[model samples]
Target: ADLSQKSHRYVRSEPGGPPGKDVYSLLRCRVLLGRPYLIEGNLLAPNALHDFLLCDDPTDALETVAEDWVTTGHDAFYVRGLQRSAKSERGVYNSEYIVFHAWQALPLYRVDYTLE
Candidate 1:
């Protein structure tokens, strides 16, 4: 299964506007999904959030795409049916994709989320 397809499933947030102002100084939030994830690392050096990177390289980051829709290079569904062994294995398969990114995008709407 394409775990990436399940995109924001791991964000794990309850309904809310955000944490208190103190949270801003104590924790950093994840982009796309509003979760208070990493703590503010060493203040001695600037740009400490780099230490909380989920991936080593930004190139590893995939282009933004709909989570429910099939990935750019992958078919939505083909593993549904196992082929028959008696005859030439051939069942029916059709790929389908439903867009779910809208649900993820709305939270970050026109709101300003600056760390003030």
Candidate 2:
């Protein structure tokens, strides 16, 4: 549960600044040990980030809603790296979700990275 290595970015919507003004924050974190652990307490709350459940492989049957509100309207917040499931029939598998609020924040349409 140590988030020391994690990096975060915060953005606030301007203009009228309505109640609960759409605020967005990006957190980059890694789990030394892979598993589905709860990262944020509340997904729809302000300054909340998503949980990440890392897995060795991917699953197919799991239907993922890329645009779910829990993803904070960020396409980068959805599940990834799921190509096989060890416990496919048992329905027990590993995954991760970038949890966030989506009401006021603009959608995260894309993510780009160059491997080192």
Candidate 3:
């Protein structure tokens, strides 16, 4: 499936505030007509969360995406690295590459492949 086509709503820590502080530090993402997944990672360094959020590098965000995919009954889904470009900036820039990097690291989490 073309997972990129899916639309997502960011569930910030506060109703109208940015993520991180006082928040669950969770990324709630879902696929259209598909299940929802929670991506858990450190908001601080030593982990790629910072790079995944700020840098235009996809290599930093792969593990989180893959964790969500597996936990949300989409284990079969393949998370390619973020696509980089000169104009790319922030997490959105090289999201694909960051994702690939995360996948390689393999974060801790559980997967529920069976449909509910």
User: How many steric overlaps are in each model, in order?
Assistant: 0, 6, 19
For model 2, residues 1-116, the per-residue Cα lDDT tens digits are 12311221223333443465543344344323222322211223222231324221122223333322432222333233332542333221233354333432444443322212
Question: Which 10-residue span in candidate 2 carries the lowest summed lDDT?
Answer: 1-10
Instruction: For candidate 2, report its TM-score.
Output: 0.17
Clashes of 1: 0
- For each candidate in turn, the TM-score is 0.17, 0.17, 0.16
For model 3, the stretches where C-alpha displacement exceeds 4 angstroms are: 1-31, 38-60, 63-72, 75-88, 92-116
- Residue lDDT tens for model 3, 1-116: 23332212233333433443342233233323223233332222333344333223233444343342332252222223244522223223222222222333433543222111
- Candidate 1 residue 33 Cα shift, in angstroms, is 4.7
Instruction: Tell me each candidate's RMSD, in Å, in order.
Output: 18.6, 16.3, 16.4
Q: Which segments of model 2 are wrong by more than 4 Å?
A: 1-85, 89-95, 98-100, 103-105, 108-116
Tens-digit lDDT track for model 1 on 1-116?
A: 12322333323333343665221111122223322111111122333223432312211222221233322432111222122421122221221122223342323222222235
The parts of candidate 1 lying over 4 Å away from their true place are 1-35, 38-42, 51-116
